[model samples]
Structures are given as structure tokens and as C-alpha cells.
Target: MTPPPPPCLACLLTLLLLAAAAAPPAGAICVPRNPGGHSKPGAPAKPAPPKPKPLTPAAPAPPKLTPMAPGADIVRSLCLKTDYPDLCMSAIAKQPQPQLPVGKRLDGAGVLRLAMGAVRTKAAEAKAAAGALANDPRTQPLARGPLHDCVESFDDIAYSLDQAAKSLAAGDRDTTGTMLDTVRTDVDTCDQGFEEREELTPVMAKHDAELAKLSSNCLAIATAAGLR
Candidate 1:
């Protein structure tokens, strides 16, 4: 048995034990009771990562050119030649053949008017042929040959007619008659040349019939006006 401890020492030891039990142990921090703590109530969760978007492919470009078929070219050529006949017929049909006073001689002005009308008609026909050549696929490639030839011939006829008008305007009867004859010959030659082309045979025939009627009407007018 040991001697009993002092009363003051015993009291101090009891106070030290109570303080140790109330506080946290060494090397540990005291945590407060709050919503952010481990044992707290409702809290927000972390968000998920976003998905990547898909890529789209670009579209291809269109072709630059397309080659024409053989049959298509042939058809286009025929169609182009046909246009010449149609135009020529239209010009002939629309010609104005006015009857003059009986036994009245056509003055320079009167003759010039008549020749100008004829030349205008020929120009219209030639212009139509040129347009047909430009527009028709079949005839576009061959335009330099038969189609161009037709246009050139009509141009020559128009020129001759224009000269006739000029001569008549100048009061030169002899020169006007000569120029008229030349124009008629040129038109006949053009008609013959068009007929020679196998591709233009039908068209030429149709033109010939219409041209014949026009020529006859023109001759009658010239006779009435005392131009012949």
C-alpha cells in the first residue's frame, strides 16, 4: 500500500481527462456540422461530359460538257435547212404587188420603191437562214458549207437588187433593167445550187414553187408600171 495521493493533484488529473475526451485527438482537425459535410442533407451531383458532333461530307460538282449523239446532229442539220424554205416562203407570201394606173410609166422613185421591197424580202430570208444555222444542232456544225452557201447566195441577190434600186432612183432605165436581169439570174443560180444539195432537195423544191409565183407577180407589176 502506497501513501494516499495529495487531494490537489487528484483534482488536476480529473480536469485533464475531461478536456481530452471533449476535444479531437492530435493530428485530426475538428469538423463542424453543416450541409457540405460528409453526413449532410441534399447536395448537387457532378455533370457528365458532352458528346462530339458528327462531320458531313461535301457534294460533288456537275460535268462541264456533254457530247452530242450522231442521230441528233443529223436531225438538227435537216431542221436547219428546212427553216430556209419556210422563211423564203414567208417573204414571198408577204410581198406587196400593188396595181399601178394603166399605161403609166414608172418614174425613178416608183421603180426604186419596188426594188427596195424585193431586196428587203431577200434580206429577211437570209437572216432567217443564219438564225436557223445558229440554233439547230444538226445544222450548226455544217453551217459553213450548205447553210453558209445559202446565206451568201441570198446576200448576192440582195446586193444586186439594191443596185437595181439605186439605178432606178438615178433615172437610169438601161442600167436598172440590166441590174434587174442580173438579180434574176443570181436568184435562179441560188435556187439551182440549193437543189443540188441532196439534203436540201425537198426544201429547194418548196422554195422553187413559192419563188415562181412571186416572180410571176413581180413581172406583172413591172409590166403594168411600164418598167420592162
Candidate 2:
């Protein structure tokens, strides 16, 4: 037409038309990807955030001391007036002595009854201790003789304590005093018997010491309560 185009110019025009036809439409967008990668889409969405854990409350503190009932201190204060005040406080302070209402506080006899209950428990324990030592293989050979004496001595204490309880109930303080006095001596008698033996084990001394302490505590409680 317009003086026929040159051969080189015609060839270049043909290449431009082919490239335009192969290109994507206007408004079409493509995401760039890593070379040799397998991702299928536009930008990968961020992973969902982790859920939060539930909160827990701390536990409350425990109380340091327990409240006492009225007249609870009476037992301890009465114990302080005895010869074995230290012993009484150590043995009885932590133990609860039932408190009476204001007009009906425990009198001397009532306190003595409480002391007797404690004494009987110790007596039974002493009896069982000696019996156990006498039978135990580790202690039998070396401690048998002394343990036998201890058993008998503690048995007498138990009997006397029981009799004293009856005497106190009968309003016979004199008899109760005599019985309690014997109970105090019984512990010493056991010790003396052990010392007289050909062999003395530390076990003998140890148990006798405990028996003496228990008896002394009972005696002190009785005296403080004016049992005599």
C-alpha cells in the first residue's frame, strides 16, 4: 500500500503482534514464587494465633493457732502452782481439759479425776513397754531380768492408781494419798532393782526414767488439786 514496507520492518511488526496476543489481560495480577517451589496461591496466610490458657487462683493460708474454750487455761495455771510445774506444763498444756460453764468450773476433786485418767494411761503404757522389752529378741537376753522387775513395779502402780480413784470417789482423801504415794515410789523401786542386777542396760535406765517422770507429773497434779 504505502510504498510496500521494508522486509526487516515487516518481520519486526509480526513479532510484536504475536507477543501482545500471548500476554495476560490488563487488571490480572500474579504472585511471585520461589524458584522450584510448590506453593499454590497468592501470599500464604499467617498461621492462626494460639489460644490463651485459663488462669488459676492461689490457695488460702492456714490458721496459725486454734481458739481455746473458756476455762482452758485453768488446768495449766493450776499446774504452775505445783512442785513439778515444769513437768506439768510440758505434759498437760497441749492436752485439752474440758471446760465447764462459768458457774461450774472443775474443783480440786474434778481436776484430780482428770489427772488420774492421764496416770492410768501412762501406767498401761509402762506395763506394755516392759512386757515388750522382755519378749523382744534384741532386748530379751540382756534386759529380761530388769524388765521383769519393771513389769511387776508398773503393775503395782496401776493397781494403786485404780484404788486411789475409788478412794477419791468415796471421799477418802487419806486413802487416796497413801495409794498415790505408793505409785510414786514404784518407779524408784524398779530403778533400784535394775541397778542391783549383774548387768545394766541403757534400756533399763531409759524406761525407768520415763516411768519416774510420768509418776512425778501425776503426783504434782494430785498435790496441786489438794487431794491430800
Candidate 3:
């Protein structure tokens, strides 16, 4: 028979047996109750990534406008007096700088002269355009006769304009106005031929319209300045 164990040894063996019985099996896994909090002791957890800020909208831009030249007040005021202010503005503004009196200033009489010069150049250009259209092979058969009429009318207009210039130089405002009226009438006559024939003379019509506006401006300037 074997001898019995001592009391202390027996107690230690009892504790070891209890611990083995409470442990997990060989193939079993040990899981934590709170996996999120499972980190190294005393080590701070990484802060969650910062949220992105919302975007803001932008405002609309202002409208763009044409820039006016410095010291153009006289030109602007003169143009305002005309029936076709916009046309007057462009015509006078396009002249050579030297043609304008010192400091780009002009009295009523000077403005009248400037307006007349613009009309004279425009009339010549219109006459040439009419002649070109009349001779063009592509001109419509019905439009040809009207185009020729426009050319002849432009010739009459040129003569009238020359007379008007002479009268203006001689300080004959009444005669100048009369000649300008004739010029305007000749332009209308040319346009009338096309209208009566029901023919489209787009090129000639454009020239006629421009010439009419120039002449009208000249007449208005002449009337206003004649009072002085």
C-alpha cells in the first residue's frame, strides 16, 4: 500500500484540479466582451477622422460695358442733339484726331462742319457700293434696274452735297438745309424704286439707310448751328 500525502500537498493538488476544470477546452477561442475598448494599457486610442466641412456657393458677376474715351463730353453732347445719337457718336468719334480743334472741343458751328464732312464721305462710299451692286453678275435680274437707279440717285446726291458744302462755307444756312433735304430725297427715291419693283437690294438698301442717317444728322446740326 502507498503512504498518504501530507495535508499541505493535498490542499495544493485540490486547487490545481479546480483551476483545470474552469479553463477553456484546447480548440475553444477566448473572446472579449468589449472589443472596441481592447487596447494596450495606458495608450490613448486614435481619434476618429475629422468630418469634412460643407462647401459655399459663389456670387454672379456684373455686366460688361463699352469704355468711353477721356474728354469725349463734347462729342457725346453733340451726338445727343441728333435724331440718330448713336450714329452721330460713331461718325464723329472715328475722325482723325487732328481734324478736331485743339482739345477736341467744338462749338455748334464746328459740330455742323464735322457732321457735314462725315456725310460727304459716307455719300461717296454709298455711291460706290450702289455702282458695284449694279455691275455684279450675281445681282438679281429684278434688282438690277433698281440698283442702277440707286447709282444715279447717288450721283444727284453727291452734287447736292457739294452745293450744300459751298453754302455752309458761305454762311448760307437756308440753302444748306435745302440741299441736305434734296440729298435725303434722292436717297429715298433710290429706295422707292426697289420698293415699287418689290425687289430686294439688301446691299444698296444698307448703303441708302446709312447715307440717310448721315444726311439727317448733318441737317439737324446745320439747323441748330444756323441760329448762332
TM-score of each: 0.43, 0.61, 0.62
Model 3 poorest ten-residue lDDT run:
96-105
| lDDT winner | 3
Which is the leading candidate under TM-score? Answer: 3
Better-scoring candidate (TM-score), 2 or 3: 3
lDDT by residue (tens digit), candidate 1, 1-228: 899779999999999999989997779966556643554444454466888778777787887878753233322332233324343334433456445577654342453354346555745565475557646776535333555555665677678667767776676766766766665565566466556655553333444444444443343334444454
**Candidate 1 wrongly placed segments (more than 4 Å):** 1-112, 115-119, 140-144, 204-208
Clashes of each: 3, 0, 0
**Local accuracy by lDDT, each model:** 0.53, 0.73, 0.77
Q: Lowest summed-lDDT stretch of 10 residues in model 2?
A: 87-96
lDDT of 2 by residue, 68-172 (tens): 744447666666776666655555544457566667876666666666666666667777888888999887475687778888988898898889889988988
Q: Rank by lDDT, highest first.
A: 3, 2, 1
Residue by residue across 50-89, what tens digits does model 3's lDDT show?
Answer: 9988876667688797786543665677678889999997
> For model 2, which pairs clash?
none
Candidate 2 residue 88 C-alpha distance from true site, Å? 1.8
What residue pairs clash in candidate 3, if any at all?
none
